[model samples]
Target: MKKLVISIVLVNLLAACASQKPHETTAAPAAPVAAAATATAPATATVAAAKTAVDPLNDPTSILAGRSVYYPFDVAAVQDADKPLVQAHAEYLSKNAARNVRLEGNCDERGSNEYNLALGQRRADGVMKMLELGGAKAAQLDSVSYGEEKPKATGHEESSWSQNRRTDLNYAK
Candidate 1:
């Protein structure tokens, strides 16, 4: 009977030691498998979702007729040769002066926000001045500077940046 009690005590002591010690293998492998699954699963899902979405802004039919003039990047200092384009746009605006028009000036993200804002304002003002010269009433036109807030394309190349820098003409709804 004493041997039986001693054997039981030894068994209980061994069980306690096993429970108290750190679990070195069983817990460690599960953690890495969980982390690996988490890292790869969501990334592929996001990419697939992005591929399915369509961009509304890229539709050419949404562009307004009179306001759709695409200007070169940073043509603030318009030369004598380029004066005709402005003149043509001004004439178009004057004819539709009864309808309110809004000019949104924009720039690429290369410059500081403040500087870009000022530059965009100047570009819109340049167009406004030409329209006024062509007989559009001052009240008919409204100008706003968007700076680098809206980009035409999401590329880092100069071509994409150049396309981003221009004024967009919006007619009052």
Candidate 2:
């Protein structure tokens, strides 16, 4: 009976540790993948499931699948770490001309509504400009500011603010 109780406590402790750990990624940087995709011929989708199930844009292995461009507090510029994500999406957009993407700009819940809206717009525009420079056509991109009104995290701390300050790449069908 003592052994069983000890085993249960050990199991609970292990579960608690596992649940508390943050997600870690060892995936290689996104730039090289984008460059490779640009150099190679478009991959053929042989199976019907392949078409919908394995879209490069949605594929976990593809850099194009990354959609968020996180920003620093009070800053609208894209971080160096996230630029590759933007670049990959740019390459994909240039290759697939029919697809349209909306950049939704957001801000943390700390500033005046007017100020946050402007900052969010700047964030979206910054990404839009980068995409254009990366070969995406102006017609394929659009930007909208949600500002403090739409936050990814609800908490009023840095952790939450970090998530809230981002430009989301929302693809249209």
Candidate 3:
């Protein structure tokens, strides 16, 4: 009976040992540290998408070099100095009449829409006159008035208002 009982106890112990996990002799081969590095690396396609999303106008040099020119409205009263800028634009247009150019006149938000529209038209006419003087044919240039409908800056402050009150020359191919 003692031998049977000992055998039964030994069998139970063996079964328990079999169910439990065995102790590892060596540490898991330093789980490839490079896996963590590769996981954190930015995807190539995502990086390309991010690059493509950047605005071209964010660069001041690009804005300045572009064919579009901005003219101050009220404060910088139309003066003799502005003639040269207009002339340069006219020359550019003469050289490229096959391409159409739009002169958008804008005004500050100080006046009613009607008044602003008239003022914007006058501003555009002023630019047109100069362009004509500079040799841009009437057929090549088109003028439109945004009035105060579209503003370069949204704030009510004078600085923003000043920026909003301007003419923009946009060239289209």
| lDDT (C-alpha) at residue 118 in model 2 | 98
lDDT of 3 by residue, 1-173 (tens): 97787568656654553343121101121132233225436676664564367422222222212332333444323444344445556755665567556778888787798888887777777787777777788988888989889988897645566566677777664
RMSD of each: 28.6, 9.6, 31.2
Best lDDT among the predictions, by candidate number: 2
Clashing pairs in 3: none
Q: Residues 73-156, candidate 1, lDDT per residue (tens digit)?
A: 455644333344445446545655556667778887877888888878877777777768877788988888887777787776
Local lDDT at 74 for model 3: 48
Which pairs of residues collide in candidate 2? none
Best by TM-score: 2
Give the least accurate 10-residue stretch of model 1, judged by summed lDDT.
55-64
